[model samples]
Target: MTADLDHPRRGGLWHHPEFRRLWIGESISQFGSTISQLALPLVAILIVQASTFEVGLLVMFEMAAFLLVGLPAGAWVDRMRFRSVLILNDVLRALALASVPLAQWLGVLGMEQLYVVALLVGVCTVFFDVAYQSFLPQLVEREQLVEANAKLQASESVMQISGPSVGGLLIQVLTAPYAVLLDAFSFLWSASWVAAIRTRPAKPERRPDRNLRREIGEGLRFVVGNPLLRPIALCTGAANLFGSMATAVFYVLLARELSLSPGLIGLLGSTSAIGGLAGSFVARRFAERVGQGPAIWISSLAMAPFGFVAPFVQRDWTLALLAFAQGAMWLCVVVYNITQVSFRQGLCPPALLGRMNATMRFLVWGTMPVGGFLGGLLGSMIGVRQTLLVVAVGGALSFLPVFLSPLRRMRELPSYAATV
Candidate 1:
């Protein structure tokens, strides 16, 4: 490696070979995941002829592992190799997803299989996601965290932009069941690239005092005790809880109520990714100008109006309104994510990174299961449009926790090095 690669600063990760492999692998992986994101729900909804409530449960099962094993997995992975965890999970998820295509081919596919596969994939995803975040700091320099995250987010956003259209097309051609095969293959492709990565993060040191419960507590305390993380968690948790409700039922509205074709549904969903891509394109500059703290709250506030606009979408020129609303809301979402996640990664001590990330994930993502349940139940009780309106209003304002807290006062992403 050249000196530039050895001691990169100021977004010099672009010169790093191993990072490129990781980036490319993850980008493809994300595209595959996006295909499943559409395919899975479609399979549940159309293939099985599931109700709105079943679709909600399917979504819930997909994320339920975060609640079941989230905390413990963090403590577990802290002592394991990041590469091994990532690779193992990728293969596991691939196998789980591959089952869908196989079952569909065999004419034995049903809701039970979908639920089991969702649950298994979710368990693997919890591990992969936690490890993926914790592993990145090991790949690049501390200062490059923002740029690295930006690049990754940009690619992810790009996948979001293009993946859905492709997914919808594939679903149209192959049916949703077979379309999921791409996601399964994508996981295998990712694992192969990860296996080739030359830069291995050092194995975490194991301590004799490492009790699982104590380690878990230590991680939780780090998040809860930290002034910055606490509010971020609360705010993110609320956002996911409310936003996921709409996500659970949004496609149902598009497919069943609005009677959109798969191609149109995918095209509409791609609008959100367009916003995310735009946000990723501009996140660094925006944060630099506005300061990360202000950026966070302002982005949150921007989401409110966008959130209000989504439920009002109709089949006519109002379609453009959905695009604008979804685009604007996701733009804010991406900006907020890039800002806060970069801040969180840079703020933590290396020893606590896994636990800290795990705790944060648990807090933010654990509510999703509840949200999925609520989306289904409420969609059933109050009707789909009414449910979307309710969740949109709550999700729109979910940013209040961070907006009301110290984040609003800090001019930039505050350095917590001294505090940690």
Candidate 2:
């Protein structure tokens, strides 16, 4: 049975039947998402003629969902069946994305309409993300999580590398709204794919206290009280804050400061896929040798050095190489996430997974807007180079959470489960 199941299909999790289906669906969705990432901004720039402040406002609107919806939605998701939630999220996102193109075709595209779509889609994304993270542990055995996450990361990495290039092409060939149509299709595909996954029915428990404040508190307590989760949360949150800060100025670096064309930037960013793919492969080995905890620490520390190099690139080619390094740096993040997520999932009682996942993300992503706002502010005041240097310095400081926590000494994913 093991031999037949393990037959190398695509040289990794692609060989597994269930994982293959999930991967294909997710990949398609990612491609579409990539198109929208490019198309949406172009729509704002070319169609709406939005100003920098307007663009920043739009970004804030999009990200606001994470801050506003993540915790509550996570609490709700823990009490409900996750599969249906994921399916609904995809369906809703598809409809939301479709509205943009449809409205454009009807000659009624407006900033109001665009903002609404961004806001709604972001809300949907929060729910989908919370549900998806909680759902993974049920799909695979505890032992195979590293491989599973690696495959998932590889898929996302591929999309990250290729999605923008493809999106850019579609935008060039078919205008921004039409380019978004591709992503709408991808969401539909994800919805259908999610509907096909089969898992054992969860043993329903009494719904926790219905008071909104109490439920939210319960979720927060679960995350804050967990031995392993608390430190991971703090470390990841700080890292996310720093990364968001730097990303806020990346486009300015490419377009306004570096004087690079969109096509070149897209191509340069594409090279990051190789680094992600490489990092995914390396992750499994690292976990085996040093353990998930150490892997997380190493990956976290490595990211700071890699990020600092981008501002120093002197030439276009060098910039691209640095971008590849950045991609690899991000890949390390993916590996850390996979390991940590799996460990968390395996250790936590399934009943608490949703809230735990949500709580962690809420705290981590909650800082993103602050980071982005600071990024833009600092970039404007001090210059993009100085802003990034600051981000790098702050990002390096993020490792302090892990260093101070028990993760500093952890050698591997604990063989005997340690409850949160």
Candidate that would win on lDDT: 1
> Could you estimate the TM-score for every candidate?
0.97, 0.89
> Measured by TM-score, how close is model 2 to the native structure?
0.89
RMSD of 1: 1.6
**What is each predicted model's overall lDDT from 0 to 1?**
0.88, 0.75
Model 1's TM-score against the true structure: 0.97
Model 1, runs deviating above 4 Å: 1-4, 9-11, 416-420
Model 2 residue runs over 4 Å out of place are 1-16, 106-111, 200-203, 206-211, 312-315, 415-420
Residue-level lDDT of model 1, residues 67-144, one tens digit each, is 999999889989999889999999999999999999999999999999999999999999998999998988887778
Q: Cα deviation in Å at residue 178, candidate 1? A: 0.2
